[model samples]
Target: MKYTNPVVKGFYPDPSVCSANGKYYMVCSSFQYFPGVPLFESPDLVNWTQIGYVLTRENQVMLDKINSSGGVFAPTIRYNGGRFYMVTTNDTTRQNFYVYTDDIYGEWSDPVYVDQGGIDPSLFFEDGKTYFMSNGLDDEGRSGVIQCEINIETGEKLSKSICIWQGSGGRYLESPHMYKINGSYYLMAAEGGTEYGHMITYARADSVWGEFVGYAGNPVLTNRNKAPYLIQGIGHGDLIRDKNGDWHILCLGFRQIHMWMPYHNLGREVFLIPVKFSADGWFTAGRDGTAEYEYEIKGDFEQKEKKLYTFKNTSWKIDWCHLRRPDFDNYEFYDDSIVLHGSGITLDDADSPAFIALRQRDFEFELSVRLSVDGGEAGVTCYMCEDEHYDIALRKSPEGTEAVLKLNIGGIKHIENTVELSSDSAVLIVRGDNFRYNFYAASQGSEIYLGSGNTKYLTSEVSGGFTGVMLGLYSIGRNSASFSDFSCNYK
Candidate 1:
């Protein structure tokens, strides 16, 4: 059957997967935003459901005022002996840690800090012993794909950290995973800085220790050289075999709005690439080892359609996200309405704001929300980070309530357009396409088109962050606001 690329969309990067009881569980890198790592479950290699995140407790993951792209990095999820383990790096504190859970539907345990200093840490369990791997410095002060035997229960190092492979000689040698295949240890990693030149390389050794030989056809997988391709930045993959013993790789890649433009605001997403292993005990991924828009898989998995979640029937916990540490005490969620209290902190500050957002899963969509504010301002926004966002806000001006279009680029604020509202309430509409997002306001039986902002200015290449655009409802100042009948949809 034909399946699409980017099995998971929108800012879910550093793809990692592990199987348990014939079910596949996956995780992706979530930087700075609260609820660190977004989690998913798949019956086959395709259709995935957002179950929950690995780091949800305040003590498990740290994200207190850390700037965008400063929190959790690459996360690796592995299941063994009826227990699930997730290891990752808290880039904000430069700390490496792991958390475990016995129940797939429950909260994870407190972090077990590893002594290693690195990013993109992964766990490999072998014959009652656990191994920890990451792309960082080793005991010899050598930096590469480092490994060490670790006591999983105590986070204690049972062996010296060893530098297994230095990559295929590319910049940013990160996101390493180790696997034992046919009595040989194989190490796979990503390089090329995760941009246009990103790729995946591998090496194998007889033992799990040093002197590993690089694969002759090194970059076993990459789309760096593929032109006119909709998807690029293909690398940082994890291998998993399904119930039928068919091998598959879950990797990270991005989609540009246009073939001519390299910029992408949807952020790095998860892509599924099928793996083929020969009798020679070697594996190749994707067709011709490059990513594409669609793929043929070995399973009879049917595609899961995305449901349109109108606010009247939205799943608040599963979809909405809050910035920094959540001030949940100041908000309430209901079936038909959301009551949010504004803080003195503006959206311009990295501090906590009264905001809850949904990941922008589609490049083109329509979002409309009816908002009523008592004193200050309340509306919607296309939020990238604190410094880069486009707002269509309804603020209480000296001349009564007014609709305003404010654009914040690189910490510089610009008020592009404003119009007085005949009433204190209005319906704010944000229509987004590949190029720009246009705003509209409707009140007192009439509608007015606000302004539009370029999408390129809010992308990672220009905004300097690890996140994509998040469409959210927010309130600033001490006004208590009520928002209802919110609807965001794509056909």
Candidate 2:
């Protein structure tokens, strides 16, 4: 079967995976989103279903007024001794923590904080001892991938943090994961940032505390210079062995809108690449050390792609996320509909507005929703951050209800188009392609064209954030809005 590059899609960046109990479970970074770490389970590596979130309870993590890419950073999920532990860093608070659960389906326990200063934390268990690792400064103030032995029960440091492997001469050396394979301690980390220059570099040592040796041909996997390719930013990978005992790397990458555009609006997504170990115990990844758009693999199950998503098919708890910490009083959820109570909070601020969103999975999609607003404004938004979003809403004015289209790019806010609606309820539609999104309003069996916005404006390249575009249903300004028949069909 031939599987696509991004087995998981849409804003789910910095992926880490571990196999347990005959199944593969994965976690990804969720910056500034309420449910911090998005968790997914897969029967095979290619097909993944989001099971739940790792940070469900408010007490486990903090996101109040955090910047767009501020909260929960890269998360590493590991399974050991009948328990699952997810270790991550809250970049907003500059603290590292881990949450554990014996039952993966059940709610996770409260966080146990580690007095470590770094992001993208990972835990390794060996010889009845737990070793915590992150990319930061050691006790001697040496900058590199740091390691320390810790008490897993209490997160108390049992040994001084020490620098292990520095890297292979790339900038932003981060996302370090320690693996002991074939009795060799292998440390993998990403470098050259998480952008176009991203690459995965590694080194192996005889002991965990190395004297490590960098691979002669470093950057085991990357698509940095594979220009004019849709897949970009290929780094921050976690190694996994499949049911057939073949090794693969589950990493994060983004699809550019165009080959030469160098702009990506769909956020960093998950990609699976084949890895092979040499006779001397060194490994190389992808096709000739680069990730591809698709790969043919030997698997028992077929690779499937989800093309249509609706309220009935998607789980509200697993598929939907809101900005920062949301006020529960602002939202009312039903089986087929959602009612949002608009508050004074708006999308322009860092505060949590009445917004619930799903990640935009692909470049071509048609999003439509039937919305009815009683007083203020409610609509569907293509949201990237506080400053970058496109909204098509039904607002109540003194004259009547009007359909409004707004494009917000950085400091510029423009109402591109509007239509006088005959009724309070209308279907808002947003049709998107690789280049742009077109807005429309439908009422009385007629579709009115609102306007369009360029997709480049909403990309992380232009928006300057670590997230991708989200299709959000939102309301604002002390009103009651009911949304129904919402669907996003991707082609």
Candidate 3:
């Protein structure tokens, strides 16, 4: 059967996968989002479902005053001894920790901090012993892929961290995972940064530590020079063997918005690469180590895609999320609707505001929302961060509510367009394509066009963050508003 690449889409990067009880589970970097470390489940590698998040409670992770790209970095989800463990880095706190739960669907335990430094941490359990590895300096202050024995239950170091392999000559060597395949220890990692030159490399050794040699054809997988191809930055992958005994590498990759346009507002996504292991024990990924838009798997299972939501029910909150830790008392949910009490915060504030949004998954889609603001401003925004976002709001002007379009790029705010209204409520619409979005407002008898704004300006590349564009509902100032009829349709 044929399956799509990026089985998991939108800003979800640095994927790590493992199998338990015949089910495949995956996790990725969440970088400052309130519910940190998005988790997923799959029966086959190509099809995925968002099971939940690894960090829901504030105590499990830190995002207080954290920058857009500063919270949870790459996370690895592993299963051992009937317990599920997730190890990650809080880049903001600059700490590494692991959280575990015996019930996979239940809330995870509070973080068990590890003494190790650096990021992209992973845990490997073998023969009643657990080992931790991260891309940082060892106890001796030597930098490389460092490893140490640890007590899995307490996260206490049982041995001094030691430098392992330096990798096959690439900058920003990270995302290290160890495996014992065919009696040989294989260490895999990504290098060359997480941008255009990103690539995956591996080495093999008789044991977990030391004397690991690079594969003869180092950088076994990379799309760095595969320019004309839309898929780039294919690295930071995890390898897993399926029930059928087939090897597949689930990695992170991003597609340029257009054929030649070099901007991706959807963020780095997850892609599946087919793996082939040689009789001698070396494995190659992709088509000769290159990622593609699709791959033919060994099954005939039909793909069940995630549906575009109209958010007409109580479950809307499941897909909608707030910035930083949510201000629980700011809003209440009823079937198909929400009442948001305006806060002193605005989208311009670098802190959490009265906002709830969903990831902009597709490049071309239409988003519509109906809002009635009692005071201040309320509307939908294509948000990247505090200093970089595009907002279309209904404000209570002296002439009644006004439909206004705001463009904030790199901290410069501009009122691109506005149409004063004589009503208390209005329907705001946003039709977005890969590069820009067209805004419209409809009321009693008049239809107002609020002009268009470029989408590229809100990308991670231009915005200098670790997230993608988010379509959100926001109300600012000290008032309250009712928002309903939210819908998103993909083209």
Give candidate 3's total backbone clashes. 0
- Candidate 2 overall lDDT versus native: 0.93
Best by TM-score: 2
lDDT at residue 200 of model 2 (Cα atoms): 95
In order of appearance, the predictions have TM-scores of 0.98, 0.99, 0.98
Question: Per-residue error at 182 for model 2, in Å?
Answer: 0.8
lDDT of 2 by residue, 1-491 (tens): 88877899899999999999999999999999988899999988999999999999889999998889999999999998999999999999999999999999999999999988888899999999999999999999999999999999999999999999899999999999989999999999999999999999999999988888999878999998897898999999999999888999999999999988999999999999999999999999998899998887777678888998899898889999999999989999998899999999989889899999999999999999999999889999999999999999999988899999999999589999888989989999999999999999999999999999999999989999899999999999989999999899999
Error of 2 at 240 (Å): 0.4
lDDT of 3 at 411: 93
- Per-residue accuracy of model 3 over 233-272 as CA lDDT, tens digit each: 8899999999889998888888888878777788889888
RMSD, every candidate, angstroms: 1.2, 0.7, 1.3
Q: List the residue pairs that clash in candidate 2.
A: none
| Candidate 1 residue-wise lDDT, 1-491, digit = tens | 78887888888889899988778899888887777788888888788988888888889988988888888999999998999999999999999999999998889999999999889999988889999988889999999988999999999999999888899999999999888877888888999988889998888888878578887886888989998777889999998887877888889999998888878998888898888888877788888888877888776667776747687655677667788897887798898899889989778888778998888887888999898898878789899989999999888988889999999999999999999998989999998889899999999879899999999888988997678888989998998999998888875
**In terms of TM-score, how similar is model 2 to the real structure?**
0.99
- In model 3, residue pairs whose N, Cα or C atoms come closer than 3 Å (at least 3 residues apart or on different chains), thus clashing, are none
What lDDT score goes with residue 288 in model 2? 85
Query: What is the C-alpha local distance difference test score of each model?
Result: 0.87, 0.93, 0.87
